[model samples]
Target: MFKFLHISLLLFGAVFATCARAESVLFLNPGSTQEAFWVSYSQFMQAAARDLGIDLRILYAQRQPEVTLAQARLALQGGDRPDYLVFVNEQYVAPQILRMASDSGVKLFIVNSALTPNQQALVADRADRVGSLVPNDEEGGYLMMKELIRLHPPVAPGKSIDLLAFSGLKITPAAQLREKGMQRALAEHPQVRLRQLVYGGWTQQRAYEQAKQLLVRYPDVSLVWAANDEMAFGAMRAVSEVGKEPGKDVLFSAVNTSPEALQAMVDGRLSALLGGHFTLGGWALVELHDHARGVDLNQYGGRDRQIPLLQLIDREYARRMLAMGATPDYGVHFRKLSAKGRPVSYRYPFNLQTLMR
Candidate 1:
């Protein structure tokens, strides 16, 4: 009787441990289903969640702030509240979500778009706020502009390289950071005269229309810098409509790893493309998985981890990426990227090289 009772207790403990290992993560995607960048981002994250044995749920906000808030409220208030919530600071709506999640006891992790310093102050005391994983947007912006300037050297000695810039919404933190980086690069190169900087609203149509008007307004603009791929493509179209060659007459540079952008790079239409930050959501999953398994996330990079995930996708690299196709097989051993059982010195391989490997 004593032996049987001991065995039953052991089985109960084993079951409890298994249950503890299971965790659910809710991802609030800030883009529509048809949006290429966000769709790819969620796909990569789903692959990671599968490998880590995490139950991941995604809710799209269709790029609307009100929809995002509404979906978040529904998810949080539902009887089946997720154990963790991963979100982006899209259009400056993170604070409200953070407060809602904190009140409901759901651990929060911000990805892609991180909170500003002032926004962080609002939830500084919330221990349930896990951390943030964001790319160095400013670095990405600065690099894209620097390359554009390099590719389009002045026609004459001391000639101003006229440029037209397309930025996203000013209220978005990511857009603000990217613009800040562009400004830094512009400041360094005094001859690169920015004729005008207009908000493209992150849509190809709006960017196309804006480009049409801006191109005519600034005909001497030899350089065009867009904050994203869609806007870049729009600007390219506008350049072509205006009887100027895209890659030849007016050089273009932008961010994001959409297949269209990669193919454009291959075709020599896009002068520069910086990307690979879509893996942020996947990397965040790895961190959360390790944290759930008793790994101290603080040892890696503390609460707010800003990683240099963006890299310049040259022609050769662009070809390699394109070969992988639209829904590229991530083929990543997500567990290998975790810090759960690794040494203290083990660094997380969170870059394009990892994806290529």
Candidate 2:
């Protein structure tokens, strides 16, 4: 099993003697549609977690936070042996969830975004679990847009921005923080006209429907700022169905270097894509494994449990990502997949300045 090397744990290769089946890790994904964005993320994490010898059992929600909370509460209270409680989508439920885990002796690990000040204080104060593993969303969003501005100069007077937006959940900190960074990026381009910032709600079908409505409402508007690749894919479908070129005719930028989005950026279908710390899920699982194995960091006088890593992608650098395959952290190699999955690189990257008229 490929286990992360513990800097302090004197043990080198096999942590457990060859016999004990690896410790089980439980995952609660927001939902389970094959095409769901989190589903892809969960699969990637599955591969990485397995590589690390985690016997992972996954549970799904009905895309409802309440459903997710119910599932989580049951898992924590379940008869099955429990070690760690991990989640990604529902930030609002975090504090209460962490509180519930306290009595059960379950450790919690969060991913994809940071907990708010209250949640952080509570989690740390209560020894709820460990810190968190999240993307440097502000930096990722900033870098992606920085590349966008560098490559694409607006045609209009002020290099302003417009939006064709979609987000998975308003509660998830990622969408908000990325938007914060993107807004800061636009501060640099004054004349950028931000027309429609419709919320797609993150579902592909809903995203497509929302975008189609926007397309009808503003026939001439082009630039699109999506929250995640799934929405972009939905928007992309809408554009294609309407005989509109996704990237060339209309600008598309989103967070998360999802497979299709990475391919789109490479193929010049998406203007830019900012990477997120999706791989940290498995990395976190390793940490969770360490904790479960009794490698107590707090006992070792180590304070911080949260570890954050970020990756950003855009047209200027999208080619390299496309060529190299976008997902190294998540253990994803796009080229390893079929031609449909093989990443495509764009020879001529999108120029934001040129695209905005």
- How accurate locally, in lDDT, is each candidate? 0.88, 0.63
Q: Model 2 clash tally?
A: 19
Candidate 1 TM-score, true structure as reference: 0.93
| Candidate 1 wrongly placed segments (more than 4 Å) | 1-20, 326-328
- RMSD to true structure for each model, in Å: 3.2, 10.5
Best by lDDT: 1
lDDT, candidate 1, 68-168, per-residue tens? 89888877778888888999999888888876775686788999888888877765767888888999999989999999999995577767999999999
lDDT of 1: 0.88
TM-score of model 2 vs. true structure: 0.75
lDDT of 2 by residue, 183-258 (tens): 7877887655566666666667888888778887777656677777778888888888778887777777776655
At residue 88, candidate 2 shows an lDDT of 67
List, in order, the clash count of every candidate structure. Answer: 0, 19
